[model samples]
Target chain A: MNPERMYDALDRITRVRGVRGAMVVSAEDGLVVGEAVMEGVRGNAVAALAASLAARLGRAAGAAEAGAQRFVHLQAEVGAMLLMPGADGLVIVAVTDQHVNVGLVRLEMQRMVEDIA
Target chain B: MKARVVEPWLLAPVERFVRESGARLTMVMTPSGQVLAQYGFTRAVDVMSAAALGAGIAASTGEIVRMLDEPDFRVLNHQSAQHGIFLGRFDSRRGPLLGLVVYGEDTSIGLVQLFFEDFVADLEEAAPAETPRGPVLAADFERDLNESLATLFR
Candidate 1:
């Protein structure tokens, strides 16, 4: 996808309340394809960690005959991470605070993935 | 795989990095091409060749960055379908150290880079105070190189 469109997608995701950042990352190598993050967020680190987790989860799912992973949510004490696997080895990742509206965020991310596909 | 280091202090950090990063091959050397530690290389010739090429790439790229008047790049990566190579530079008590890592599809560059930060920190903490050595003379160059290689492979 074009850079502008990629950013637009991320912008829409980050527009949701409590989302610190959003990124399009390569699941294979954890490299950032595009991102829209706040000033203090570490986009590179988040992209890397998200890709790693997605790959591991995908493998685990395959091993268990569970088919492909549709979504991943990791909740921590202070914040949360949400991942939506997309076509062509791409993943849409969103970092959010604990108060984030998970339902809305997931809905928007699903839309973004469909758009990319 | 086990990592062998010429300097004792490098052993723990290099070994940890090797295990954590899942790198198929790795080498730690000075910017001038002196090998300090290595993992997963069976042949001495391959080690020396990789060291030479890695140092050369770092030097040439550093010069290119200088020409552009840009800040030095922290890490350089090249990825293909099945494997990736990561070259990073870190500052230690002795001086600048370069790390070259080759990883397969089992691991990604992001994981390697993420662990490399911890490796650098461990190395910095473990490195002993610098002890100056006499400049390498033409006659001693070959002997020193062979000895270092022997230490690594032995």
Candidate 2:
């Protein structure tokens, strides 16, 4: 996808209430394709961690005889991470607060993935 | 892969970096091409050759940056179809150190760079106080080089 479109998608996701950042990252290499992050958010670090986690989850799914992972949600004390795997080894990641609307974020992320594919 | 370091303090940080980054090959050296630690090298000759080339590249690039009147780049990366090479510089109590890494398709530059930041911090924290050393004579240079190589490979 074009850079403009990618940024637009990330912007839309980050506009969600409680979302700290959104990024398009490469699942294989953990590099940021594009991002819309708030100040103090380390985009590269988030991309790396999200990609690594998605890759490991993909492996675990394969081992369990499950199909490719469509979505992943990781919850922590203060924040949460949501990932949506897309085609061409790309993944969409959202860093959000604990109170963020997970359903809304997931819906937008799915739309972004579909747009990429 | 096991990491060998000429300085005992380097062993822990280098080994941790190799394990976390999944780098196929790594070499930690000074700007003057003196090897401090290395991993994934079987031959002494290869280690010397790589150290020389890595230091040369850093020097030439640094000069180029000076000519352009730009700030020195923190890291240099060369990505190919099959592998990627990363060379980064970090400061420690001893002096500036250079880390050269070669990684394959299994790992990405982002991951390597991410772990590299931690590695540099660990090294900086672990580095001992620098000791004064006499200048190397032409005759002793080769001997010192060979001894360092022996320590790394052994």
The TM-score, computed over Cα atoms with residue i paired to residue i, of candidate 1 is 0.91
lDDT of 1: 0.91
Q: Which interface RMSD does candidate 1 score?
A: 1.0
RMSD to truth, every model: 2.0, 1.9
Q: Which stretches of candidate 2 lie over 4 Å from their true place?
A: B133-137
**Error of model 1, residue B24, in angstroms:** 1.0
Candidate 1 C-alpha lDDT tens digits along A1-117: 767777778899999999999999999888788899999988878888899899999999999999989999999999999999998999999999999999999999998987877
The true-versus-predicted C-alpha distance at residue B44 of model 1, in Å, is 1.9
**Candidate 1 segments whose C-alpha is farther than 4 A from its true place:** B71-74
Candidate 2: tens digits of C-alpha lDDT, residues B51-151:
99999999999899889999874699999999999999878787788999999877789899999999999998898888886775767777878889999
- The DockQ of each candidate is 0.69, 0.72
